[model samples]
Target: MSKQHVHGSHPDIVKRLKRAEGHLQRVIAMFAEGRPCLDLAQQLHAVEKAISEAKKTLIHDHVDNCLDDAATGGPGKSARNVLAEFKAISRYL
Candidate 1:
């Protein structure tokens, strides 16, 4: 199947990536300083949650804009494709 296009690469996505980078740097520092396992785990969990939230935001935007546009003049194929992609991504989350 052809790759589905999504409307991302927006300013918000870029900002989220920058924040995630900062979070990762802190995680590295925590490892270097021999931080407590529980503390490190908590921070990692927060990072994961942030990333997940960002992803959902991007996906929702794409569904609302890009996918909605693509769904026109089809047998609802574009919508089906978008739903399939979401399902696949949900497995990772």
Candidate 2:
């Protein structure tokens, strides 16, 4: 069956990811320039945080939309589908 396309958070996630990508480029440039270790570590921390937040946002969107689909009005909301989703998201824990 064809998958449903609910791109509610796609644009927002893309913006966040792009922001993180810019930060990562700056970090790489800073590293090459022999920036101070403390400053570099701080920049690295920011990059990590941005990426982590993006990951969390994507996971939240997936869980919200996909679980709602399995439990409500979209399609194929059988117990099996819900169980499958639960098992799939367990890897994130």
Candidate 3:
């Protein structure tokens, strides 16, 4: 099957991931600069949460679009495949 979907969340998710990337880079730099543990932990936590949120958004978009389409008899998909894909993605939750 084609690997593209019509979801509108892709750009938002990319922006979120980029923000998380920036946070991660700053955290790495802070670690190298000998920043305090608490400050570093907070920034790292922000990065983690940003990434987690982005992942959730992407997974939700996929489920709403892809799985729903497949379940509704979209071309080139089967119930077993949709179930497998849903099972695979649920691990991230």
Candidate 4:
């Protein structure tokens, strides 16, 4: 279905992902520049953490808004479908 508007925390999540993307790009450049292994590892870790936190925020927002809507009869999917969707999304977390 078409989205009606920006969901909760999505704008923040997008900003986080963009930051992570920038970090990842820097990490790639570091590799090419023969940066020290310790520096590379630290940068890579930051990138990984950023992506992980973004994923967590997205999933939590989905559960808080979408699943809550479905449970409250807010023009969402059926109960079975909602549960399935929740399960599907939870795998990423």
**For candidate 1, lDDT tens digit of each residue in 1-77?**
99865355567877887898899899989999999999999999988887887887776776666556656644446
TM-score versus the correct structure, for each prediction: 0.69, 0.82, 0.88, 0.87
lDDT of 4 by residue, 2-78 (tens): 95767869889999999999889989999999999999999999999999999899889899998989977978489
Residue 84 lDDT, candidate 2, scale 0-100 = 85
* Model number with the top TM-score: 3
Predictions ranked by TM-score, top down? Answer: 3, 4, 2, 1
TM-score of model 1 relative to the true fold?
Answer: 0.69
Model 2: residues with Cα > 4 Å off, grouped in runs: 1-6
The reply for model 1, stretches above 4 Å from the true place, is 1-9, 73-93
C-alpha lDDT of all candidate models, in order:
0.76, 0.83, 0.92, 0.91
As for candidate 4, its clashing pairs are none
Least accurate 10 contiguous residues by lDDT in model 2: 68-77
lDDT of 2 by residue, 51-78 (tens): 8887777778877888767777677678
Ranking by lDDT: 3, 4, 2, 1
Q: Which ten residues in a row have the lowest lDDT in candidate 3?
A: 1-10
Number of backbone collisions per candidate, in order? 0, 0, 0, 0
